[model samples]
Target: MKKIVVIALLIVITGYVFAAGKSEAGAGGAVEIKFAHYLAESHPAHDAALAFAKAVNERTDGIVTVTIFPNSMLGNSQELVEQTTNGALDLVIPTEPAIAKYVKKFNMVGAPFAFKDYAATDKLFAGDFIKWVTPDLEDVGLKYLARWEYGFRNYTTSVHQINTPADMQGLKIRTPPDFVNSATVKALGGVSQTIAFTELPMALKQGVVDGQENPIATILTNKMYETQKYLSMVNYTYNSTHLLMNIDKFKSLSAKQQKIILEEAEKAGLAMQKAVREKEADQIKELEAQGMEVAYPDTKPFITAAAPVYEELKAQVGEADFDYYMDLLGKSRR
Candidate 1:
């Protein structure tokens, strides 16, 4: 009787351990990835993230699954990246400038007036840029997956129209809490007030800052147009959100699973890029209809005023890397 009881206890204990392992590993021992980003559900990136998750799961036949947390549900942009780095999270999509905090060389991507248009961006992002940054990302326990569109940063002001660099002087501008953005605004002669995106609406309403800069889609979706009276299409800097995964988490996946994830990420990124570019004009129009004045300022003076920002980037990233990046940018230009 004693032997039988011991045997029964052993079997039950073994079963419980097996069940717990299976639960942690997900259904059928599938690998589950948690992806988080700051974009709201209305943004195209969120839709693309959902589609990416769906396609990845289908392609892998339940061998892998991705769950997305949008609208900073996990944390803000900077915090999300930190969590992914420490392996507390599996994946995150953060703006390029945000990544520069971890890898300083990434600051080159945010150099003011670096990209002329979408064609230039498409060429660079599709080329060796990813390869160049891969090792650096790995150093910080991140694997760069793909580049998705954020859009060209433009200025919107409640104080006055920003037709020239001179107009930006002394105007308090709310910028993302990143060095590149703050430097860009300061170089353009505006006082940079770094603010978290989640708190921006209240800041604008409270007159904490006179104006802000963001992509048209973001402005429209976030209702920033309600706070600001003017939109200036200076296109000072082009921005992209990079999909990153924890290196250890990515390495734990089988080769086939990794390949499938990469392919789906690229496809989803391209989809997002296409959606953003196609809707930008309509988004700007919507902002105008919301009682905002739109202006296509002569960007030459603005570009010239932004030259100091490039110098600062060069100082931060070193001369050789900066030159190499510039060469890549030049070659990418159509």
Candidate 2:
């Protein structure tokens, strides 16, 4: 009788232990979030986004998981931005102009010749500017968690070597829908039109557009080299992406969980920045190998053409604010 009682108690305790373990494991094993961007899997930006997801998952011990939707799997950049604003998407990494729809101030970063180079670009993301930008993201239902550079913009075309502002005149250029970018092309005396990135190759082949600008990493990864004959090295504006999370979705996590996720996200962005700098030489080499006539153009003329934008920015935001952004621009050069 004593043996029977002991056996029954042992079985009951074992069952209870299994049940508790299962509950805990099931409850804390996964937190799924969507991260959207419009770059191919092989693109540096995509790789960086993946690195961010990997870093976050590792740091959080599988408690937080990100589902990266690259190649515009979720939708186009514009559609993704809309989803993010309406809370249909959890996170998105969009270009500077995309954010201008909601937070116009953020667009200041994209001014022509905005950053002198990568080091200055890093300063803008690291200092007081980030603090000011974060709240603006929240105002639009998104939270800016991190900023990462995608390198400087490089121009490419099949018919011409665009070494001067005059070379761009009368050229049909594919540009982002943002007025600022179109304004940029206008200032250069080019005809600017918005084209979806996925359809850009067709546009080029069909002569619907003359050329476009992108990072060398992007021009190579998308195989734009096949359609583009000229790769002009116009180190114009440095394009940076904002890693934004939907505020409501982020608020669903426990405070401790949120803190961990944010810390890990910063790590992911830093890793991406490192990847960009390190892989740049290889990326450029790949483009040149793929039959691209990579021209090292003097950007002085292009920079001069964009001088009018400073006056336009002043009109919209007043001289004081415009000057403030330009001050930031100068810092980027240093």
Decoy 2 TM-score against native: 0.87
lDDT of each: 0.88, 0.79
Check candidate 2 and list the clashing pairs.
none
Candidate 2 residues lying further than 4 Å off, grouped into runs, are 1-30, 316-320, 330-334
User: Hey, what RMSD does candidate 1 come out at?
Assistant: 5.9
Using lDDT as the measure, the top candidate is 1
Per-residue CA lDDT of candidate 2, range 224-299, in tens?
A: 8888888888777667777888998788766666776687677777877888878888888887888888788777
Tens digit of lDDT per residue, candidate 1, span 1-334?
9999999999999999987666544444878899999988999999999999999989877768899999989889999999999999998989887898898777888788888888888898777888888899999999988888899999998888999889899999999987778898898899999889999999999999999999877898789988899999988888898899999998887666788889999999999999999999999888888999999988888877788888888888889999989888888885
Q: Show pairs that collide, candidate 1.
A: none
User: Among all windows of ten consecutive residues in candidate 2, which has the lowest summed lDDT?
Assistant: 20-29
Name the lDDT of candidate 1: 0.88
- Runs in model 1 deviating more than 4 A are 1-28
Candidate 2 clash total?
0
